[model samples]
Target: MARVLYDLYGRDEQLRFSPYCWRVRMALAHKGLDVEVKPWRFQQKDAIAFANTDKVPVLCDGDQVVADSFAIMRYLDDAYPETPAVLGSGVSYQRALLFCHFVDRQISPALFRIVALDLLAAIHPDDRDYFRATREARFGCTLEEFHSPEQGQALLYKALAPVREVLRTSPFLDGETPSGADYLLFGSVMWANIVSRQAPVIEEPLVGDWFKRLCAAHNGLGDQALTVRDLGDEQSA
Candidate 1:
């Protein structure tokens, strides 16, 4: 049986936008695993109850069910030792872990502000109330206030300063080749690209170049992903 990856999608199922899910998607591809992506929405918590987690990026490999993106990545690496390493060396794996945390805790929150309204508009109708309630509580403001494009863009640039400096010298965060750390950061940017009408621009020329390289990876898989506007006729054109 092909592995089942439960990925979060918007109203249009093809527009898969969850950053965490993207990380796992790239990781699976990195390992050359065949996966069937099942589009999941926020309101469909019961659909993934078997995994005992309300969140997405759930991996069901036969009898084994893994929730959480990081856990699923580790599961893939451990279960399929013959495949290419997802985390790479011990030192590299440690660095990847830190980068993942940084992306989640630092980068994602900033990016969320810019895309919050667009994300709200794109989610399934059934999930609207749930998403709004949860996100409003987390940010302690209305969605509109939270989704201040200008402020969000400034925060995003500030948060990405370290990444810009690193890319100034190295091709990838892990040195020569793209590593788990690179995927972690790329996934965050993919979040902005998929949900927002205005994609956040990386100020550093090298950083922009690195993003283009990532978009061209896996035979242009990233570039081919459906953006929010792609769901509409105008953006599709």
Candidate 2:
């Protein structure tokens, strides 16, 4: 049985920069599962039609096809019981879900405003208009009219206060190691890191150091991500 993941990408197929997909990628790595990742673009709805969803981060594990990032992570723990659980049970699971919701409702929106234009510059040409049309409609403003970088950065930092407080003492959200909550927030941060010319930073030593450690986890799976942080100087030069 072949394990495969439909991951979202930018202009360069190698630039798999979808935050949700990154969540799944890290979850899979946590479960010690190796998958062949297929890059999907915004205009490629037909490609994932079988999953009954237009979104990427669809995992086809043998006969089971799981769509949605969070759903896929839950499925991994169920199917591969021997692997490390991405989400703990009881109160732990509920807490993780709560944190995920906070990131989705708060962190993601502000971060998007910061990198929306950078993402526009990076997506496949065929998906450009669709990306802009949908995002602009959702945000109620043209991408160019969206929050300025300075504002976006400030908003991101403010929204990240909870996570920053945690990292100030704990190495990971789940104490010594990572949990579902860590992956959720990491995905949001990766969104800013991968596309922004200058990746948004919140408390350089706190969040910054934690992010570096996350990128190095799962055998450097995320370390391989195509972050503009790596090319920011060249792009500006």
Candidate 3:
């Protein structure tokens, strides 16, 4: 049986845009694992209820079911030890783990504000109500008020300062090579790239170059993702 990856999709089934899901996709690609990505919608909670979680990026490898992206990555690394390692040594692993946490806690929220409205527009119509209610509660504001483009852009730039500083000195967050840490941050940026036309500009030339390199990774997977503007163009004609 083929490994199954349940990925979050947008209005179109092919529009898989979840940052967490992208993290798992990149990690799987990094490990040279082949998977059948199943497009999952926000309203399809019962479909994934077997894993006891409504969210996706769930990996079902035969009888093994993993929910969280980080857990799934660790599972892949541990289960297939001969494959390329996701996490490196003791210290390196810790650093990678820190990047994962930083991307989720610090970077994702800032990027979320920028793409919140665009994301809402991209999701399946059936999921709109559920998405709004849950996200509004979490944000403590209506999506309109929360996703001010200017504010979001500013916050995103501020959040990315440390990342820019690091990339200025090294090609990847893991220094010389792309690692789990690089994928963690790349996934967050890919989230922006997929959902919105406006992306947070990295002031540093090195950071911008690094992002370009990442976009070209995994056989141009990031480059292939359609942005919200691209979707809009399709609808307009």
Top TM-score prediction, candidate number: 2
User: On a 0 to 1 TM-score scale, where does candidate 1 land against the true structure?
Assistant: 0.93
Candidate number that wins on lDDT, 1 or 2: 2
- Which sequence of candidate numbers ranks them by lDDT, best first? 2, 1, 3
Task: For model 1, give the 10-residue run with minimal summed lDDT.
Answer: 228-237
Off by over 4 Å in 2: 200-203, 228-237
Residue 169, model 2: Cα distance from true site in angstroms: 1.9
Q: For model 2, how does the per-residue alpha-carbon lDDT over 1-237 read when each residue is reduced to its tens digit?
A: 899999888766677788899899999899888899998888789999999999988999999999998889888988998889997667877887888889999888888777778878777768899988998898889999984777877887888888778887899977898868889989978877887765554446788888888999989987888765554343452
Q: Each prediction's TM-score against the native?
A: 0.93, 0.93, 0.92
- Across 67-138, the per-residue lDDT of candidate 3 in tens digits comes to 988888888888888988777657877877887887888778877887788878877778889999999999
- Number of the top lDDT candidate: 2
User: What clash pairs does model 3 have?
Assistant: none
Instruction: List the global CA lDDT of all models.
Output: 0.83, 0.83, 0.81
**Which of candidates 2 and 3 is the stronger one according to lDDT?**
2
For residue 26, give model 1's deviation from the true position in Å: 0.4
